[model samples]
Target: MDEIQLTAAAEGMPNFNRRKALAVTGSGLAATIAAMVAPRNAAAAVVVNEAPVTRVNNLAWALARAMDDWMVDLGVDGVPDIWKAHVYPYSQRKHPVAFESLDRSPSPSARVAELEAAFHAEWAALRAIEPALNAAELRYMEIKGSRPVMGEMTPEEADRLRSTTVADLAKLPPNRASVEHAEAMRAYNKADAAARRKTGYGKLDRAYMKATHRTSDVANALLRHPAMTLEDLASKVRVHRVWEYDGEDFNFIMDDIARVAGKAGAS
Candidate 1:
């Protein structure tokens, strides 16, 4: 994408940008906090010592390596440009780990197994939350869209209906029926919004936003593969049941990624 589009995309990703900023500025603070909160009991210390930072490090390393292998399998040369442009910047912002950190870590095989287990756990959680996330998204669309729900119409159409009288209804033609329906729908939506405010819809909105951002991150990362087209990436997401709750938005994200990738390729 061009500079303008890139800027817009970055602006849209408020959570990602906020996290990036925190990662860059709060690394020291995070370390300090971790140290301060660390358990001092002998038994707790033993458990902590046995927790194996090396294993965690190795798992991270293996995940990265696996990504590299995937890139190679796709016949891409060097690292993905999107990784350099996006993911790597975020990672470096989050933690200034050295290239040799992976080499220094231990338990490579066990770490890989741990990674697989974590993936399964996360997948399970994602499935459990899918229905709620989907419902939240539907409600969010109702509050935000021109057509709040099925059979609803635009505000413009509603205005047209409001301007027409019952005496003029017959002369207003068949299209006016839609306008009348729209007016009724608008009233219904207005009442719905007021009711939603009292019932705490903001929490659901927040949840939907979080889920969208998380799904977008994964979608963008997958789209970075050189051989992956938008359709291919979207199919993979569907097959994996990733972002099943927000299929339409995820498809839009894939399109955005494809646009960026195309621009990058052309330049």
Candidate 2:
């Protein structure tokens, strides 16, 4: 029995092997095994380390990615004419209802009202989940903040420093606010700031996720409606037109929804 250990690293995280044994007994076994195994191991490592690719599950997400790619390819200021020339053609071919015939759809005011109602419903659901979300956020902040700064100190070194600092602070004069006391206060404040910043960022991320999920839900629901054309759906949840100007691009609106629901089964 020959036991092989396979490992890979992705973003500093280790990947453990599932299969442990490959049995072989033949001439030139060592050479054969090495030839077969090295490339496989290397490929596995690369796959594990790579970031997840964005998937387009529906027409909406596909349109968004296409528009984004078009903008990147242009590499200059995005004027309406250029957008019509380069980007709109692709969208027209892919989703004609939304792009080729915008003027024949429902009024923007009517669509906005429907979208607002859906948004309000999702907002209520979010409020219901707020307490649990807040608790999880607090836990993340505590764990992140307490993580000892790496490189200069190990866990053991950090433990030693914390123990010594506490003892030293305890030996100071009880009544007098000495320099040591001030230093300790500053250290505490620094740690608190780090925790607060981390927590704030995490909160923002959660809020964004909540908003995205809500938007995705609304967009998906509208898309699924059998009677509505793509333009009708876009008008309801996207394509915000005001007076003579198109207030928001179709790509921007769809991209926002797609970011949250691009992958299949992302509700």
Candidate 3:
């Protein structure tokens, strides 16, 4: 039954491999989504090229990818309400929605409202899981934040370090402030590692990363396509599910989601 469902879902998608389909739940997941999300040039050796390329051409498919994500995740027939309001005919060939999405904000009112609601919901979920603590992380921040007279500073580095926080310095590079910032990171890494005795999956960070740092890459590849039936939706979710990012953060997906959501609203 699972095999049948997966096979059916793969139909009409750009490329589908039954053997490669993921089981949709487990500790192991990679690749199936890599195919769906693969760059256009990465799919296969290009035998053909369309002359006079344009932005709409690139966006036409990206729009599809964005929608595929929406359909599978939201289980909705259309994209968010904001996107639908922006569409123009293909002949007109202007895309305000795409511009705002790739850059930022849909409309001031809509984008703010949408992002606020989405982020509020997200933080609510994360806060619910809180009271979480990691002594190692705290220790890392502390050690990294320390300031002391050290031999390694150039006059510029020393001057900057005295003027600003180490955290602020870390964001600068090839500059006066960056010197101590890098040094601080080294101290922090050493202290953090010694404190934790483990570098990865420290429990709190992992869950936090899942909730915060994730990327959303798991929508079915069909793009702007709707599920034909309940079984179809299930199949789409399955073959599509294990294939890509389940916990992808909003930032990575915001552009695409905004594009599709706006596109859906255009009609």
Candidate 4:
């Protein structure tokens, strides 16, 4: 739906989708929110005109995304009590009594109490299933950004590195530290040194590049700074791909991630 239509539907007004919609269970409410959380965006394409844009534009976009997330959290399909107050008592749809009675002439202290209670009850229920909710959110992001649904560091690489480093350390003479400990220390040193060498760098760099081509970093980068430009994101490092990074695009993404990570650290 268009943004205007989506907004209208969210405001308790009926829309085409609502006409065709089926009654959803409370159990599936979280999934329904997750499905609607992600805003529709066009595919990655270079803007040829490259008009001058201000930082405000980025902030605005970020706020828009945040609102979308908020809407999802409040049960887009079910409607949270907070919104229901303003929705119900005026239509066939249900509304929170607190909202409907907001302008009541008598002291509203009683209505306020009821509103608070209902709010807490809903909030508690949400918190109870928050972990699953978060997982669903991550899955939605990955799907939206065309990123890898599952990622991992390979055990084979870890084992091979361990073995090679251990072999190198075995030649070291023992000191006050036990032979086993000394050998382990040497192995670790060897591993660290090897990782600093060209091969290790190449492996990490290549993986970042490959992941970028698939927009695997999109979900991560956008989540942090929704306003990131295509060029701005071209410069970061990633190490979560089957193949190593070797292309110009990969190099850029790696640099971007590295720069952002550094800034985050300093901050």
Candidate 5:
């Protein structure tokens, strides 16, 4: 992609899909908070000892890795540049899209298994902090909702709650922290792209067109999935064999491919 188009594409897309953040439900609130506030340099340490112990971690990682590997298996070279530019550094929701795409020749299912295992291990360690996490959450909630009255509650309860909340807020969970770090990185990229776009990168519309066209093609292929009829089969082949060759048309092609693939399975 040319500098101008690259700048525009980067700026046009969101850094991370906030929708993914909705995964933080009920009890997972602690996990979410932890993930957001934890320190970067301490991820490994925290992963080993402080990460949230939830089944969702493994599930999320497995699916993420599988999706990424599947994209690579379909043959788009080197992590979709758009994802790298706009998604990867902003949140775990999108990071796997690029990393597993670049991984060499692993079957999508296999990659999924690998990531699932890794997540399991990490979560096993993370769950250990549940007690502290819950305590902190309760404390933080109390403090934020209403300031503790001097004599409304026992001095010990007040002290414990305040101290625990302070600690929790001070050190966010590892996964949560990673997400925030990625967000900051994405913000930086956005700023840089905006600056570049303002500066004369505006001329690279052709490159953007080229990339988006191929992306659209992949999308079309995915849409044509489940090829039951000869017509559908032909369309799939045409899209996959012909248009798929052009990266600019990839998105459309993939869409058709997915549609056909889905239909085929149903049949």
Candidate 6:
């Protein structure tokens, strides 16, 4: 695969299909986050610790970024010029032992594992409320006469669409919402937002944001990481193999992101 796109690569494009912020129902994305976050072992091994942890990932991002910057300054032969421009310091900075341990510790370090656990907890909380919000969006036109709050989606339908976005749900229906529906939607959304917030999803949102930033930091940092050659970078960021050596496209594609989006978010 020659220069295949790093679907979620963070140079220019940002959100890495945050809906799937690390893992799916429980697969694939762990590696994606791992690739960028924990480059050494990269979450390949099973995590045994489930202690509540925080800031570990942010620190990990710090170290990986430091490593990448270090390599960039070394003027590693294969490093991309834009990547050199991309790193902030153009030289490695000091890392705390805790942060450096993110790379040095065993694969899926206890802290990393705890971070993932926290992520899943938050991800689940957000998902629990989204279907109702989504159903409301899909059924927006009938709100005044429709169900009181939710869009009336069945568990089966919600399950099928668990991964679909509000926009995706909107696309499935042919109902033409009148301009008045926008006002209705506004009220409904206000109530919905308040109700969702009442469920304490704000904390969840903040936690996921931290994890994702760290993960994306890892992805961007990899471009500067010493072990990651351009070839390695090419392989890690790809959605999948297309034609053999078809060519690289490091740009992030929204469509690809949606395809892999799982039940989570960075929003």
Best by lDDT: 1
RMSD of each: 17.3, 21.9, 19.9, 23.8, 21.7, 18.9
Candidate 2: residue pairs that collide: none
| Superposed Cα deviation of residue 219, candidate 4 (Å) | 36
Q: Tell me the tens digit of each residue's lDDT in model 1 across 1-267.
A: 011101001111111122222344445644533332342223345656555677456646655765464334322244231221122333444322211111121222332323322332333333334334333434554565354334554577677778999998778544545667778798878876765554446565565456546545544444333323433343344324432334455565566577658977997
TM-score of 6: 0.26
TM-score of 4: 0.17
Higher-lDDT candidate among 1 and 4? 1
Cα deviation in Å at residue 256, candidate 4?
Answer: 62
Q: What are the lDDT figures for the candidates, one per model?
A: 0.41, 0.39, 0.38, 0.35, 0.39, 0.36
lDDT score of model 6? 0.36
Query: 45-162 in candidate 2: lDDT tens per residue?
Result: 8656554442213434655556555434322243221222112233344322221211222333344435534543443344334333344444454455343322344466456556
Residue-pair clashes per prediction, in order, are: 0, 0, 10, 18, 61, 4
Ranking of candidates on lDDT, top first: 1, 2, 5, 3, 6, 4
lDDT of 4 by residue, 79-178 (tens): 4212222222325643222222121222223323333234333322323333333334344434332212223335764554456666576664433224
TM-score of structure candidate 1: 0.26
TM-score of 2: 0.22
The sequence of per-residue lDDT tens digits that candidate 3 reaches over residues 1-267 is: 111100011012343322233345232333443434344335333424544355456646666666556334533354332221134453554222221122122222332233322332333333333222223343334443244333455787667668888778767545534566668778866665655544332565667556543212123222123432333333333333433434443233444455546666785
Question: For model 3, what is the error of residue 184's alpha carbon versus the real structure, in angstroms, after optimal superposition?
Answer: 27
Looking at candidate 6, the ten consecutive residues that score lowest on lDDT are 3-12
User: Which residues of candidate 1, in runs, are more than 4 Å off?
Assistant: 1-176, 223-267
Tens digit of lDDT per residue, candidate 6, span 108-194? Answer: 323333333233233333334333333332333223333233235556555656766887787654223334465677777687666
Instruction: Score candidate 2 by lDDT.
Output: 0.39
